[model samples]
Each structure stands twice: as structure tokens, then as C-alpha cells.
Target: MSLSFASSPFSVVCSEVSFAWPDGTTVLDGLDAAFGTGRTGLIGVNGSGKSTLLALIAGELSPASGTVGVAGEIGYLPQNLPLGTARTVSDLLGISATRSALHAIERGEATEENFTAVGEDWDVEERARAELDRLGLDGLGLDRTVATLSGGEAVMVGLAAQLLARPDVLLLDEPTNNLDLDARRRLYEAVSSWPGVLIVVSHDRELLDLVDEIADLREGGVRSFGGNLSAYEELLAVEREAAERAVRVAGSDMRRQKRELEEAHVKLARRVRYGDKMYEQKREPKVIMQERKRQAQVSAGKHRLMHEDRLSDARERLSEAEEAVRADAEIRVRLPATEVPAGRTVLTVNGLPAQQPASLEELIVRGPERIALTGPNGSGKTTFLRSLLGEGPEGLQVKIGVEGVRYLPQRLDVLDDRLSVVDNVRAFAPSASVNTVRAGLARFLFRGRRAEQPAGTLSGGERFRAVLAALMLAEPAPQLLMLDEPTNNLDMASARRLSEALEAYQGALIVVSHDVPFLRTIGITRWLHLDRDTGLTEIEPM
Candidate 1:
């Protein structure tokens, strides 16, 4: 099933690749693609097998059929780094053994085992720290535990570990998921300077813009574009325009063919009637008239088949044309019940975290004001949200005036995996009937059987939507909605859909995110920054 595609010096290739989940859900089928040396941005909608393909290439997953070939050793960083709180920076960098062996050698206990572990890399620690510093993680020391690092810091450390290996191939899945503005800049520089074969799966537009080319995986195939994300988008826009026009033309042709078929039927009927009349009128010999009628019927049958075939062909063309036009739907839901009055007090935080950085002591949020919480990695933005919700540490006083306040964490663990999407939402909105819940889920694009699917079987974007449905459809409706890193791991279309869904919400919002572009799209009215040194402070929108 392998098909050769035109490529230049491909460093990675998938030949006749086919893969399916254990549940018999096919992801990729006979997918053939090749990635040339240099940075390639692998772009796709959620659940299009982009991550699965990376896994196959990185040797983390083996294909059920076909083969994946790589030019050399690989360094892979998955979308969600499997991190433990007790793991130290040295452990994360994968140099703990080497560092330990080097220390032992320095202590004059230079055994053969220690030398074997150390190998020829005596500067492993220095190189590891250099990579960390390059990614703007200098403040995080080697002995610091993962528990002390933020989500973004952990990601940076994982990347640092990969770069330290200097593998011939590098694979990064959503590398910029939790990185702040400055950290993202540092990553962009690293990506720009990468010389070897590099492939990244990310929804970050800025990061994609730095790639040498774009590889779009869709419909079980890979399409290579010669330029970056902007160029690919522009080209795609043009192609879609042409495809839409083709659809219109095909539609017209199909309609015309259908009309011609109807007209041919009418003409055949008229001919049959005329032949019967001629036979009845005795215009010729009886035998001759009968023979003429038989010939007329045969001719009519042929004519009918010809017109039918034409109509069918035209319909097939129309279908093919329509398939080329993408209709990525947006989430369109209205929640008037979540609206709040202008003078209503939503929340009042009487105190802050009892840590150093005594910057702000009190805060108040009123009405449906949308606030953006931004900060550097490890600056306690997420912790601040938890403290305000009374879910985390002690000595942090907070008073919530709103009765209906909901929080959507970055992990999206609110839903019960075993339950259907409808049931999950019903759990939050217990009073709402099944029919009523279904009618509401339709607005989120979970129509019919999709609403009945278990939460575990959903794709990344679908799970996000399902979680949002649960939060918004909760009993009494959430008057204050808090989301932490809501856009992490979300495809571009999904992110846009999130904004579209939020357009109908009339509730107060507190969002902790590092994505400034996303914050702008969601209409943040106030911008706040949290720092360990300065505590919490208000800043103007960029």
C-alpha cells in the first residue's frame, strides 16, 4: 500500500503505515509521508494521528503494518511529559548517573563502573545547564525537584534533556503548551537554529511560522507545503476558493443532467404514445407498425440509461468537490442564565498567599468583567487560582460572593470517563432532563450519537467541548468561570471554537494563560501579573 511521494533528502519516512487503537478504531491507514532534513511543522486538526505518527517515528509505538524509517537516533518530547513531583532536575535531564559518577571520580573513588557510567562526557552537567539556560531556565538548579517547578518549567527541562542528547532527529509535540512570552521567544530561537532533522507538532502559530516547511496530515494522508504556516494558509485559502467554485459548477451540472433525464423520459413517453396512435390509426401495415413500436421502445431504453449515467457522474463530481472544502464547525452556544448584573459582587479575596512578595493584600471582582492572569513560569498563577477557590494551601483567605463558581483545570478531569457525554453534563446539571441536556449539547456540536459517546473515547477537542458543556450547563449556571491554561494542547480551530463559545457567556471570567493572542480573542478587560518577588500587580493590556 506504500506510495512514493516527491521529497528532497527525506530523513524520515512512513511506508504503507496503518495503525489502529486496541478498540479497533483506525487512526492512520496506508499513510505514506516523508520529512526532509530541516524543520518541518506537522499541522493537523486534533486526533488526525499527528501525535501517533510522531510516536511511530520516535519508536515509542510500533505500527501494526508497514514500517517507519529514520535516518539516525531520535530525541522525542511528548505533549504531556510524564513527570513525577519527586523527580529532580538532574533526573529530568537524564544526567543523574553521569553526574553522580563524575562526582565519585572527583572523590578519588574512580572505579571502572563509575568510569563506564561517566563515559567520555565529563561536562554533562555543564551542557545540561547550558541547554536549560538557553531555554531561559537558569533560575532552576539541578537538585530542585519537579514539585518545585511549574508546568512550563517542567516542559522546558524535558526539552533541555532532549537537546543535550543531540540526536540526529528531534521531535517535539506541542512544545509551547505552557511557556510564557519570554520562554516562547527563547524556544523560537532554538527552533530557528536547529540544523538537523526536526519535526514539531504544535498549534502555536508563531512557532510554526519558524519552520522551513509545513507538513499537513489530514484524511489519512500528508500534504507537504514548501513554505511556512502563513504560506500554507494562504495557499490553502486559494485552494478552498477554487474547490468551492468547483462545487458550485458541479451542482449546476448535476441539476442540468437531472433535468435532461426528466426531459428524455417525457420525450420517450411521447414517442411511445405516437407509435401506439400510428398502430391504432392503421397508417401502415399492422406487422410494420408493430415492428416500428418495438424499435421505438428499445431506442427509448438506451436514451434513458444514457441520461441516468450522466446524472450519476455529475453527482459523483459534486461529492468529490464538496469533500475538498473544509467545514470545521465552531461551538455556538448561548448561556443567558450565566449573566450577572453590573453591580453584583462576584468575588472578594480578603488576603493573598502567606509567602514572600507582599505586593497586593486584597482584591475584588464585580459584574461580568473578564480578567487575564499572566505571569512567568513558576510565578504561582495556577496556585493563585487554586487558593482563591479554597482548594489549596492554608492562610490564604478568600470570600466568594457568587453562589455558582466553577473551575476548569488544565487537565480537564472534570468528566467521568465511563459516563456518556450527556451523562457527564447531566451530572453537573442534575435537574436538566436527558432531552433538555441533548438539546443543549447540540449547540456545542455534539449531535445525536456524539452526545452518547463515552467521555473517554472523545478526541482532544471533543473532550474540551464536553467539559465546557458540563461547566456552562451546571445547575444555577456558573456566574464566575475560571479556566487555567484553557488553550493548552488545543488545535487552532479548537481554540477559535473556544472563543466562539465564550462569546455567548455573560459571566465574570478569570483566566490563567500564557497565550496573549488567545487572551485578546476572549476579550480580557483587565490584565494582572503574579510574581514571587512582587506578589500580584495589575498591568495594562499589551
Candidate 2:
């Protein structure tokens, strides 16, 4: 698919832009960028100002310094979609007013006010429905309340709203975060076919791969790379390799400089000894000896200062080189105690059914089987997962053959907000001493003081890790671990960290995630899909 969009009619540019949060945390500083139409995938580690930049471009926030210039109307879909139960899809699509006006005129009230409201475009409802249908919300009418939609459905609705606006410049932040696989493909198609300037901040690999270019936000600056995510990754791999090589070379140079500095000091000391010995032996005249000693001291001082300066320069270069090499820590969990034997039965489901579109007459999870639950939004995947965990949504029965069971809900409500990460884990494993809990948390990348941070204060990725640690480190050692949409709201690095942590899990794993690539990485042995008509069915691994 062609990623190119029309140029000249749309443009967005930022020159020397600087911004900071109210708490003085710098987000963007002197960042300069431009978008002259086409899809731009905004990517970076979480908290790297990608979303902040999008906000700036969309005029949601002003830059503290510099300017953000735009030549066309902008439509923005923020990361956390503003949702209200009272709000309807029509209101969200910005067509309710027109629809009402047209309806009033059709009811024989041809008032000038209603006519003016209708304006020239009288097919607002049709357009709205068409947009929704194009985005996989075909059956969802404009009057449907936002509260009735699932997380994925809500996200798609928000996207549909933006598309209906038909703005020249579009900004989407983490657009595919809560999207199911099919919904993601629909969104990707929309993005790929966009005819205006489009900037999307997301960690969705599939969505990013459809972009024309990538804008990497890092260290309060922006770096644009041509082509999509895979291309950018290839370029980044090369850059990292070069950076590591530079670090090694600089380190070697630093050591050599230090050695030279030491040798110079030794030579200076020998010269001093020779001069003192010559003076004691009176090899030359007393005045000549004093002058010679004075010259030797000056020479030694100059040599020492030069070497010290060179060494300092080498050290600075080495530090810069090291900084260029990414050293993000990966979670390395080890939970041998949670292992389930190959022949053991972990869980059994008996006649689990949702209100509609889902039913599970019978199911059995055997051994350390890792099952990935896949389904479209509103297919009752989350509902089934919650029912399996005995959380909510009645009319479901499940038997836990295993002694230990732990479920990490999509919201990650398992951790108490007031408690520290260590304390939360300790709550689950009360028998574990503070030191032991802290040590276990370190494996989840919450080492030392990070473990002491209150759960309420953690970032999304940190919160997931904290919840995972609490679930895995419980006293009974969870043999049947269930995660509902665990990869949602996580950055690429955090998702990878999670996958790595799951590598050490020898227990039965049931993860409901839209990230198919992530499931593949974690070694999903079975795929259970919730279908609308057929209900819950086991399918071959995707």
C-alpha cells in the first residue's frame, strides 16, 4: 500500500519548540520539526515527549518557547479518549447538530435558524454512518452511548469521529493501543489511505509499518527517518552497533591516555631524581644546576598538564559514547516454584456464557499450556477472563484444579494504590521477608528504591510490572496465571520486558492480548478464540 498523502494543502511545523509540565519536568526543549503531508509514525520510549509533541501540534497545549505553525484544521485523537456515558456516537462525530437541524426542517419547521444550522452539507448522518462502517463499527449507529462500547470499540469510535471531521492535519496518539487485531487492520487501512498530513504516536508494530516515515522523539528532540518502522529499526540497529563500537574504541583510548599520563608522571619523577643526584654529586656548577632544575620542573608541569587535559577529553568522549549505547534493563523472572507438571490439570471451565456472543460449554487447561485468547471487541473475551477469575459478570462456572491461581486484570487493579510495590508483593507473599520480596521485585525490574514507590505513582509500564510481581511472587506461587490484555497501555520496551519475564514462567499461562507478535514471542502453545456464534473454541496457534 502506498503510504504517501497529498502535499501542499496541509502542513505542520515546529521551530525551536520548548515545553515543560507544571511540575517542571521538561518534555520538549528546542525541538524543531516539520510535516508536509504524509503519514508520520511518532515513536520513542514512553515519556519521551511523543504525545506532548502531538498535543502541541494539535493546539491542545502551547509551547513554552518557539512556535508551532499549522496551515490547516487539525483533528486529534488523544491517548486517553475522553469518555462519558451520556455522550452518544453522533455527538462524538460532530454531526448531531446538523442531524438535528435537518430533522427539524424535515418536520415542516423551515426556520432560518434550522436551515442555517444544516448549511450546505445535509448528509451528515450518512457520512457519520459511513465513517463508522469503514472503521469496523458497521452495526453501531450514531445514537449508541459510549458507555456501551468495549475499550477497543471505544477507540475505534474515537477514530471514526476524527475521520468524519475530514481535517487536513490529523494527530493520533496511541491509536491502536486498545484495538483488537481486526480493528487494528481497519485502522491501518485508514491510516495508509489518508490523503492529508497524519501523525500517529503508537507502539503498534503493524500500524507503524504502514507509515510513510517515522519521527523519533528522544532527549527532547525529534529525528525523522524515511520509511516505516521496520526500516527505522534496521537503521537503529546499525546506529546502535556503530555506537557500541565507538564506545569500545573510546574506552580503549581512555585507558591508553591514562597509561601515557602515568608514564609521563614516572618519567618526570626519574628526571627529578636525576637532577637531585646531579646536584648532590655537583656534576655541574651550582647556578647551572639551579637553572636546569627550574627548567626541568616547568617542563614536567607542562607535560603533566597536557596529559591530564588529553585524559579528560578522552574520558568525556568515552562518556558520550557510552550514553549513545542504550542500556535499558530487561525483566528476568525466575519462578521455578510456580512450575506445573506436564500431566497436571490446571483449570476447567463448565458452561461459561456471557449475555450474548459467547459461550463455553466445556474447557480444560492442562499442564503448563500457554493459551492466548483472541477475539474481536465485544466478543466477551474480557468478560470470559474475568468470569474465569471469579471477578464479575455472573453465570459462569470454572474449576481450578491447581492450588494457586492469579489473574492480572486489564486495569491492573490487583495492586493497592496506597501500598508500595514491595508492600503489595508482600501482601501476597506475607511469609516472604522484606529483603526477599525486594530481591524478587528486582527480577521484575523494580530494584531497590523503585520497589518502594507507591503503586499510585507508577507509570503504566511500571504499574504492569508491579502487578505482575505481585501476582507471581505470591506465597502459594501461582500455577495458573491469567492476564487480560496485559500488553495494553505498555510501550514497546515494556511489552518486550513483559514477554521476557514470561519466559521464566513454567506455569499455565492464559493471556488475552491483541498483540499477536507479543503472544508469538511468549510461546503460546494454544489459541482459544471467542466467537460470536460458535462460542469459545480452541484453535491452532496463530
Leading candidate by lDDT: 1
Itemize residue pairs with steric clashes in candidate 1. none
lDDT of each: 0.86, 0.82
Model 2 C-alpha lDDT per residue in residues 1-542, reported as the tens digit of each score: 11222454338778899997554556678999887679999887755677778888888888899988887688999866767789888777778889889999999999999999999868888887888888888989778897777778888888888887889889988887667878988988889899988999888888889999898877767788889999999998999999999999999999999999999999999999999999999988999999999999999999999999999999999999999996655666565467789998888887654434444577899999999999888787877788887865766577889878888887677888888889889999998899988888888777766677777656556677788778778868778888888876567877777787787688899988888789999999888888676688777778
For candidate 1, lDDT tens digit of each residue in 158-264? 98988899899999988988789998998899889888999999999999999989999988999999899999999999999999999999999999999999999
lDDT of 1: 0.86
TM-score of 2: 0.85
My TM-score estimates for the predictions, one after another, are 0.91, 0.85
